[model samples]
Target: MLTVLMLGDSLVEWGDWPSLLPEVAVINRGIAGEMTEELSARLMDEIDACPDPDAVLIQSGTNNLLFGYILFPTMLITMLQRLRLCYPSVPLIVNSLMPMPIVAPHDLEQINRELAVAAAATENCHFLDTVGPFQEQCLPITHPGFLNDQVHLSTRGYQVWAATIKGLLEQLFPGKLPG
Candidate 1:
């Protein structure tokens, strides 16, 4: 089975990855309430435990935004750089921060744009644009993609996220992932 190291905050931590991606072996190193900086700090340790993985998936920055830390892309890029240094050829998938009711749409867009630029500039890195898909799936409802707190994801939200991930994985690994 293909193994992937998933790192980040609550979004990553809360995912039932085994259920979400039954075909892949997932090493989830997600910490609830963790910010980008914290994730960067602990990244090496997380990687050390796993040693090697076919790919790495990161979903972070929402806590940073919630704590009013808008300049998180710099840290995220640093984390990606560290990952590249460790696993030169491994695919690094950077998941865009999902839109939340608490954050202004423009602000979220700007942050995602910065993240996309960073991912594009990095070798062997891919950015998963979850914004449009989430928006499209949860249309007409103000916050169907999120829980009541508007920060955590709802069941429907996770389904959308999982579908996006599955599609990306299939594209990246081809016939490796089951249909």
Candidate 2:
């Protein structure tokens, strides 16, 4: 079975990944209110627990936006680097921060852009844009797919996320995971 480590903040913590991707062995290492520093602190232990993950999917930074953190880009790069150090050969999918109505659209775009560049610079890392499908054109506001709160995801939102990841997995590993 393909073993994947899903890591991040609440976006990762709140998902029912086992049910969403029943075909693979998914280890959810998401914490509800984690920032990059907390993630960095616990990352080694999380990876050590699953010594040989086939891939790692990461989605974070929303909390940073929520709390008005300024060093997002640097911390994000650090987070990606740490993951590479632990699993150099493993595919690391660094998901873009989801759109948040509370944060300005331009700010979110900037963060996502920087994240894309950072992910590209790292070996074995892929930046997955989880924003475009969920938000309107160039707007920070989410479409109707999000939960009523407009921050967290709804069931349909999760389904959309799973389908997107599933497609990428199919493309990346071909027959390794069941449809």
Candidate 3:
């Protein structure tokens, strides 16, 4: 019985994947309207609340793009560094910030992919790309379930996300995050 903590936005929590999986003891610590800074500000609370998870899945930083003031990659690097310092030995799964609805200057998803790649290059960080319908071909996201809002996951959207990431989740975790 291993514990897995999911930290990020609604994306990590939309489908209640954590709760659905009983064996892994998943924790979804996603705040609906939070960015990396907000997550950083409350890191201790988030970390302390989980059930000593053996793995931590981090999918943050999309909201920062909405603000239009920061670069996604740099912010991701900073975030990864902080998390690493906090939990140096725990396995880290850095999910790419999901793509948003089609828009300029806010093509946050792809940028986050780049950041995810960079983060994966680090010793303990591994990037998880959630660029499926969550983004239009790696650019903007699409959500048929939410009347095309694209950013948020409809039930179907969450299903798609679960399908895409399920393999990876199983690969690293080995039968933890249920299919």
| Model 2 RMSD in angstroms | 2.7
- Which run of 10 residues does model 1 get worst, by summed lDDT? 134-143
lDDT tens per residue, model 3, 97-153:
555454353466457657767676667777777665454433223435333655676
Q: Give a tens-digit lDDT track for model 2, residues 1-179.
A: 88889988887888898888888787888899888777877878888898898899988777887788857768878878888888889999988887766668988888889888988999988888877666533333443556667678777677767777877777778888865
**Model 3 residue-pair collision total:** 4
Indicate the TM-score of model 3.
0.76
Q: Report lDDT per candidate.
A: 0.90, 0.80, 0.65
Over all chains combined, what TM-score does candidate 2 have?
0.90
Candidate 1 wrong stretches, greater than 4 Å: 140-143
Q: Which of candidates 1 and 3 reaches a greater lDDT? A: 1
Candidate 1 residue-wise lDDT, 60-112, digit = tens: 99998888899999988889998999999999999999988889999999999
Ranking by lDDT: 1, 2, 3
What TM-score, computed on C-alpha atoms, does each candidate reach?
A: 0.96, 0.90, 0.76
TM-score of 1: 0.96
Off by over 4 Å in 3: 18-23, 104-106, 132-147, 175-179
